[model samples]
Target: MIPRSRTVSLLVLGAICLAACSSEEQPVQKLRPLALKEQASNIVKSADGYAVTWAGVLSNANPWHFGEHVVATIVGHDAKGAEVVRMDQPLDAVPPGGSLAFTGQASATQKPAKVTIQYRPAQWRQAARIASAFQRFPTSRVQTMRQKDGAFLITGYVDNPYSVPASTLVVNALLRDKAGKLLGGGSTFVDEVQAGSPPRFILTVSGLPKGAEVAKTEITARTWGSTGRPYEDLALSGAVPVHTIKPTSEPFAVDRNTQIVSEYKQ
Candidate 1:
């Protein structure tokens, strides 16, 4: 028979091994779900067959991490609920606590009555430069014009808040009706957006259904690729103030310190 002292030692060793295995087997933390803020699709008849276009905004719910290289699978369906066309489009990274506006097009021989979209889960990664998370490009002098072909032409100027120059900036515009329903969207690119001098951008939203009235417009600007080298360079440049000062509402010609100025002059 085994001695009592030896038996006790073996039991202790086995207990320690069990605890270590349990710790190693622990599961990793689960990631939060990404939100689909809005999406719109349009199918137009073409000479060859039909043209399919789609635009959407995806939001990263997790405020700390960037969603990298998300893929979207688009499936087109005919009137009888038959699949006609399928496309797999790869998109850029979605910023932390921010949204990604993306657009794509496909050709279909058969007219698709509708289309459905699905997104693969994103691989989360830490920010290359943390300050990039707070960077924003504010737009000014924004205007929307309607084309005769039932499309929208959006014109605007985007200002680079950072000291460094930002090339390849993407401008996105979303069209909405009076009832707040998303009609369609479009995207444009602007280059050489500097700190003091803003660059102009023009985006055209086409392939919209006839008689679709656009009562409101929503516009946003962001770096071409949030996790790419361009974005990381901007982030590493320097820290920018979280807030900017706006011009006061008082009239520019009115001088509030007139009394002090008069006394000093006397």
Candidate 2:
């Protein structure tokens, strides 16, 4: 006859082994930090219906690779600043050096609501499902500014309220336009000040020709990290009309005015 104590001991040992194996059998998704360049396009042929394309800009770092179906969602307040569009769709995974666009009814989806798209591997099936049910977006913001002599400088910070780090990014800035044309070349990118440190880059304003007046300016970041490449965050920007008393007399190759103005003309 089997001993009662022996039976109990075997049952407990089997249960412990089963628990350990169960934990090992579970899968995990690759949640890597990535940055994306998002550009909106009017993919829809007709002007009436809703069709917008969100293109991704793959960078040398954190390239987008396709695996399983990635989900897209947009949530934002309507014109009245009330909750408007809240859309979600399962899109095909975007491979490296690829793009993703969407066409849908404006009425069916949230108009101005913040949008997001997320994904992972098929083994970790829940990647598409956890969903950005949370309604927190990295809002637009300006931290500081510095302009002197012929040099203009800007500083700011962007906060990603998402789970992963936004690696693919484009700082969309209309750098000091003058005479109805863009003046000065500018660069926007993150630089690693120190090894193992995240990233910190500044936007510089330089190279404006003389006699040009500062028209308007705006800066935004295009990040593919968002669930779906969301619209450029205009809300996260700051601009100041500056009058250069010292006027940047640097001539941009003698100022080639479109129809043509060049003291050293060809």
Candidate 3:
């Protein structure tokens, strides 16, 4: 959600400025140069296993401003190396020739049917705000499994064909057995995708405690957008076979690929 303060500022920027000058103005023209010379700082916060808050301060040549937004995502591997899911919240006005501080929240919970990504370019807001209107579908299934040597692995995907940007989605994963037993013994949090072009993804688990054995497993993934707001939820059984591979084993892993499905738009 956008902060009220920002909404007001944007309104003023758009309204007051239109009467004053929308384009070809000196203050606006100097924005690009000053932005290039601005100093920036970043901060990260965990909202859940799936989401986080990103805050920063950027100072330039003229005024002072602040920004707040939310972001979330999923990270994994493709046929190449690393894959991604992500999305970002709308930002506020920037100070001309001045400094501004901003914050936003992002998530990776595996819930939303469509993936999301953080967009920095000027054209992103219009598209995402429109995409936000898409209906979120249910995951309907989830499962997990463990390798022989104490390492853990999980895999699953949604059936929806809405085709959202790859940058939006926070994936939270947990492994369980056929009898609903905890194999890895706890839930795991993956890193944020921030922003990327994607739909298909496979991620690897790191920093497993020595001697932890994962035999069989079940999985749960919740995905969301700004403020940890869920857009999709996927829960299913038999998603992964437990006790098959060893976490210590390298060959065992996850992979995602985008398949184009056909449908008639009303």
Candidate 4:
């Protein structure tokens, strides 16, 4: 019973109001990008050209989310500030509430005066359980040995804290100086780390500046995948029994008296 033009105008107005209300009810979500905590690079003269090695640490500010499929672009510039070489390094996932230490190598025809790095935004995924259960891979019996060539050989045992077995995992080692500055770093992989049965790993770090003194070493472990499917599956499997302590009300006997000992001669 209304004119056609007026009816069309009222319909358009009603649709705009509905759209405005819908937008108000469901707003777009904004995510914060991952932060680059620290980074370092080394360039050495090679037989053909220059060999470049780089290390970096990516930090996830979100404690309850995992940063997936992050990529780093390394650029090498000559003294003239011209790009000589570039490499795209795909890195592993940054665990929730933790940092990821990664290393890579590349070859350049010309030596670069300095190198720079850039990172791609990571896709965020919320964790199914506590971050510690799936992401925390503990290391023990870690021993660092310095070689005559000024390189370091790091050996250690990595334990599985989840119920699922990790077919493969990456272990990273960072060498620091007395002032807590990173000198160099390296990585290694381990296979078949089962619950209650850990595997041993050996990593080597080299390409440091002359007379560089290493005062300490830092080691870390994580699952090897962009999406961390192994860790995610472990989380869905439920909580694991990380502790072996037995709880009981019954009392146990203990000998508190000290006995005299006799020395034996060979």
* Best TM-score among the predictions, by candidate number: 4
lDDT of 1 by residue, 1-266 (tens): 99999999999999999999988966866678777788889999888899888888899877667788788888999999999989998877787677888877889999999887789988887666553455778898989898887778899899887778887788888888999887788888899888878888888888889888889988888777636557667767764565679867877585759967998999
- The lDDT per prediction is 0.82, 0.39, 0.34, 0.84
Clashes of each: 0, 21, 62, 0
TM-scores for every candidate against the unseen true structure: 0.77, 0.28, 0.25, 0.81
Per-residue CA lDDT of model 2 for 9-72, tens digit only, reads: 9999999999999889557444443233432211222344333323222221213333234554
Q: Model 4, stretches more than 4 Å misplaced?
A: 1-23, 245-266
Cα RMSD to the true fold for all candidates: 8.3, 22.3, 23.4, 11.3
Pick by lDDT: 1 or 2, better one: 1
Q: Cα miss at 99, model 4 (Å)?
A: 1.4
- Error (Å) of candidate 1 at residue 137 is 1.2
Candidate 3, residues 1-266, lDDT tens digits: the string is 99999999999888877887745546532222223221111112234543332323333343221111322122322234434334444433222233333333345443233322233422111112222233332233344444664444555443332333222443433333356443222222232322122233343342244554444433333243322222322111111222566678565253322222222321
Looking at model 3, residue 151 earns an lDDT score of: 42
Candidate 4 residue-wise lDDT at 29: 56
Candidate 4 local lDDT, 102-145, one digit each (tens): 98788999999998878999988887767766657889999999
Q: Arrange candidates by TM-score, highest first: which order?
A: 4, 1, 2, 3
Candidate 4 Cα lDDT to native: 0.84
Judged by lDDT, which candidate is best? Answer: 4
